[model samples]
Target chain A: MRDFRHDHSALALNTATLGHNVEGAGAGWSPERVIDACAERGIGGIVFWRRELAGRAAAIGDHARRSGVEVIGLCRTPFLVGPLAERDATAIADDFRRAIDLAAEVGAPVLTIVTGGVAAGTKGMGESLKIVAERVAQAVPWAREAGVKLALEPLHPVYGGNRSCLVTTREALDLCDGIDDEALGVAIDIYHVWWDGDLSRQISRAGRRILGFHLCDWLAETTDVLLDRGMMGDGVADIRAIRAAVEAAGYQSFCEVEIFSANTWWKRDPADVLDVMVERFRTVC
Target chain B: MRDFRHDHSALALNTATLGHNVEGAGAGWSPERVIDACAERGIGGIVFWRRELAGRAAAIGDHARRSGVEVIGLCRTPFLVGPLAERDATAIADDFRRAIDLAAEVGAPVLTIVTGGVAAGTKGMGESLKIVAERVAQAVPWAREAGVKLALEPLHPVYGGNRSCLVTTREALDLCDGIDDEALGVAIDIYHVWWDGDLSRQISRAGRRILGFHLCDWLAETTDVLLDRGMMGDGVADIRAIRAAVEAAGYQSFCEVEIFSANTWWKRDPADVLDVMVERFRTVC
Candidate 1:
């Protein structure tokens, strides 16, 4: 078990958290700037995002090594269901291969994956799940050979149809078992699973299979499904209790802050955002 | 099995769909106006909201009967657990009693009950479920004695923490069985259960225990958990298919249109709302 309380050295900036509060040119700060900023902050770990990894891989890897920042995990290879599955298979495979190479180069341990949602042109959600499971099983060998763990992240049921096929921790574990390899595991995001009826049991079941842990609060009145994430200590989730449960489950990974807030946080100052994240990480998270 | 293809006579208008659109309003449209609108349109059934019944139950009942409108179902009795449970018990019982009286007066057959979210002041979600089960069990005898069936409506998992203790069809049916009363059953709302992986099997399991069927589409990109509901054909949900599934489960009831659209439907002319609803009820729902 790792002691994260000692310093920000154990903390991983998901980049999305910084992106949540700071807009640069496109949406928020560019991925390159996000990486540079984290490096400057003496942040311990950086979880690179797939969409932002293409042009800045070498720069990020070199900077992280020079500055002693560990790239802990990659943001994602989206789940293997829906339109993205068949229509963009080759493209997905290429991106994933690149993601694996980048992770290996940057010393990131895992590539976080959200199993894709129902096929855009279909009416069956269960059918989508089956397709996703099958595709994941097929993708396991490449991941294992690359020496990068494939961390399946189960999103909330609210996103059941359009975002991700996997909606429960137990279900993610079940899929991991089907993959039947060391490379396949889970990225446990508290925002997505805090309300689960089987949460405590599932967290315990996750054990060492929890490859990563993401933190964010679920507000009492959520306005947007994708962007209205609350910061830690801002919502109803018992963060300390959840963290204790995760620790008890044998997961000693970096606590990655991932908040997607279009309205509230995005308008704040970047320095203010990092300061608050550090403060919250120390006390609340 | 009532054919709504030719007219809106088989459709019941859940008053919340129209009346409770704008939050924090002193009062929008009167219950009498809602009743008159439904009656003039020859709508077969009008689902009465409890909020409307609080002060003017007799007047609404008389108006409905005089206008030859059938009250198909009572809107709700909200229940959760712990402090809310104790606080809501008297209020719920009083509300249920009043709802039953209103139903009797207007010839309504069922009263919808929403088992609330995890207890606020005490107990976890699981414990809250137990409290809700016990509370509903205690309320069942009164419901049976009053000859008004109590229909438990399971909300979506998004409302897992703060809105409803029950969030699945199987869970609601289990609660019904736990209560052990013929008067207790479930109201199957497509908006809440369409994304459920076990939806078809659970709806089949519901059988004749399905007391009512409510229709609303879940938008692909929902902005709000409570009010961003889509009109029948505009969203991702297969409303007609779910309706068919419920009907196959032996739910011989009016197909109720219940939407809470803050941005779209509320801003439209009320008549336009009904016009679209009736057209969709004919072609889509």
Candidate 2:
């Protein structure tokens, strides 16, 4: 395992921790400002949401690289299976390829995909997953052509109903294998998978297919399913242990910190949040 | 599978849907009133929370039986492995045995247990589950002697951290096999497990060890994790499909309707809720 104590070159900020606290009327921080702030703190990388990119993907990528921070990856593509996703396969494929194009333009090595909820007119996960797999398979060649990896992020099961049907690391890996492309892999998020009893075994199964590693704590008394994510060390998650398992699985890459704390951390100053993330990275995670 | 469209004699009500509306100032319904209401609806069985019994277990059982309503189960024991649960093995055993004795006194053949959250100081579920297994094993003999089966109710993963470390049906079955006792089994609640991709296979694996089957729906836009559960046909869960799997697995028993809807059903008249439950069970489930 690589030491993150004093050397945080492996650290990455996922911009979402700031949430509405960034770039809104009350808060004025452009993409360049966020990148510069991260670099000033010795943060090695930054991942941006598509909404913030706003068609300036290449410019933002260049600015981050020049600022001594890598654009680790893009936040996500549109939902591939839910009501928010495209209605037909052709439209879905077109939407996915567009996201892949953005990832390529941004010079991001990976494109994260939060698969949407249960498919319409479907009974259970079997058909929904089939639709996801088929749609993902269709997008693979374009992803490879752009030199970007498709990272399927299996979200927490709570989100399985409307956000993403993909809800397990093992399930994500199976989808990757079905596609049979080197461009396909998984992004392991601690928040989504920490409670899984067979996490270590599944992490072992992930091995080199891991495209990204995400950090966040699962607050034991999580009030809101979508927004009550805890910052590191503030919750009951076994952070160091899960990190060890991820490291042992050979995923010693950009460890991005992504917390969607609407009621708590998002209300704090961005600088303070980053400082605490770094401190917790050294001691707790 | 057993032609539930016209006949709901297998239906059971787990009184939590009534929440505080069942008893309190302004609510005059007693335990006997609830039992009589269920029997009047042709509901074959009913499960009661421990607080409502009030040391009159035998009396309540007799009252329900005379009204032709079976006392299917007690809602739960105190959390088996949480902060609220007894910390020491002896204390935990004493508490579990007492609950088992109560189940016997109420003539309930099964006791549903909502295993509490991760063990107090434990880091992931490994140590917590071990503690749960040990504590449960210690009480199994007592449970067997009382003719009550200890049904480990693996709650939704949403409740894993602080409500129940036992999350997945597969994991619960593994624990049951490890304890290796006839009295040890699982209660499959649709609200907790409908999102599982491997539900059917796990249901098949459960086979004869399915001590109970609880009904409710997973509303797609679920606002509250514990409350806000839907009626059978109102949510995204494939109720008929899941029932097919459970029935195929040999769980042709009293299917309990256990909805903890603080925002919806709990606010309505208990009679109306039971009427809707019977209607949904006949049409959807």
Candidate 3:
């Protein structure tokens, strides 16, 4: 595994870490400011949420590239299943294609897919997953055409109800294999998959299909399920070991710092947050 | 698949549903009172938390038997791993044996094991699980001698850090196979496993080694990770389908209702809670 002890050449900032994703959360840092901050800190890449890219995808992507920071990925597309999923079939398909388009316009190499909650009126995940498989299959042609890879992010089981139905790396990979599309892959988020005892085997199975690797910690006593995430070194996750597994599985990309620490990090200065993120990336993660 | 609508002869109450497990939570009901309530309602079994069994294990067991309700299970053994686990090796082993003795004295058919949080100085579950395997192997003699079955209950991954290191049914079965003891088996709780896509396959693999089948629902908008469990028919779990899988696996035992609803069910009258449990078992579940 590559050593991250001295430099942050492999580090990236997910905009959520700065509170750009949630409303009334962050310091309202503009995309330009976030990009400049990354460049100033020697961060190699940046990821943006859809909320920040309203109609300026191309401009933001170009700005990041001009600043020598690659826009490695986009935050995510709208959820495709569950209660939060678009109600109409056509709307779901259209919204997905639009997300692919956004990824392309933003020049993001990958577009993350958070398979939303179980579909309305569904009991367990079977029918919802089937629906997710079908929709992703439908969007494959557009993703293939746009040259934007779709990385399915399987969330923690806690989010199985209202957020995303995909809850394990194995399930995500299985969905990817069923689709058999070059454009469809998986984003391994430590917060979601850290507790998975079978993680090492699944990472080995993921190999080249592991398109993205996210970093965060699982607090021992997590107060909130949705927002209370920990900074990398502050919690119990075996960050170095998981990263070793990811790197061993051929994921030689940015180790994106994607924390949703609403009460703690979000309340701090963005500069402080970035500085600590860089330090933690080098020493801890 | 038995017709639960006709009667609750297969139903059991895991006393946590009555808030007896946590301190200062329950209605201050005595073991005799709870046992009598179950017998009066035709509930065939009762599972008691270790808290309520302080020094009255044998007496409570005798009282339940006299009331024609089998003492089906004991709530849990002390966490054998993680932070809450006893620090001294000899102490953990002694405590485990003591729990087994308590199970024998209580005459409960099985003692559920909620493997506690990750061990000190350990990073993921690897080392902690190894410790769990070794300790459980060491205790097989006592468990077998006492004729007290130990049922490993894999909690939700959310509880992986503080409550349990064991987080998947597959992982639990794998541990059981490693021990390879007839006295060891798994207890399936629906609250922790309703999101798993591979559940049906794991249940098929569990077969007769499945010693217990727990009932509950996963609320759609669950606010708490430890508490806030939903009652049957009140949440979104496919309770009947999971029970079908468990039953098909030759687990002809009590469908134990084990809920930990902090704000909702515990605040209601115990009689009302019992009535709702019966109505839900007859209709939705």
lDDT of each: 0.75, 0.86, 0.89
List candidate 2 segments past 4 Å from native: A20-26, A86-91, B20-27, B86-90
> For candidate 3, what is the DockQ-based docking class?
medium
lDDT of 3: 0.89
Give the best candidate by TM-score: 3
lDDT (10s digit) by residue, model 1, range A68-158:
6778888777556664454676666666676677777666779888777777766646677777777677777877887889888999878
lDDT by residue for model 2 over A188-270, one digit each (tens)? Answer: 89899988877789889989998999999988888998888988887778888888888999887989999988778877777
**What's the candidate order when arranged by decreasing DockQ?**
3, 2, 1
User: Which should have the higher DockQ, number 1 or number 3?
Assistant: 3
Measured by DockQ, the strongest candidate is: 3
B254-275 per-residue lDDT for model 3 (tens digits)? 8899888878888888888888
Cα lDDT tens digits for candidate 3, A78-175: 88878787788898888888888998999998999998887777798888889899989998889999999999999999999878888999999999
Per-residue CA lDDT of model 2 for B65-154, tens digit only, reads 999999999977777786566767677677778889899999999998878887776667888888888888888998888889999998
Error of 2 at B199 (Å): 2.1
Interface RMSD of each: 2.7, 1.2, 0.9
Candidate numbers, best TM-score first, in rank order: 3, 2, 1
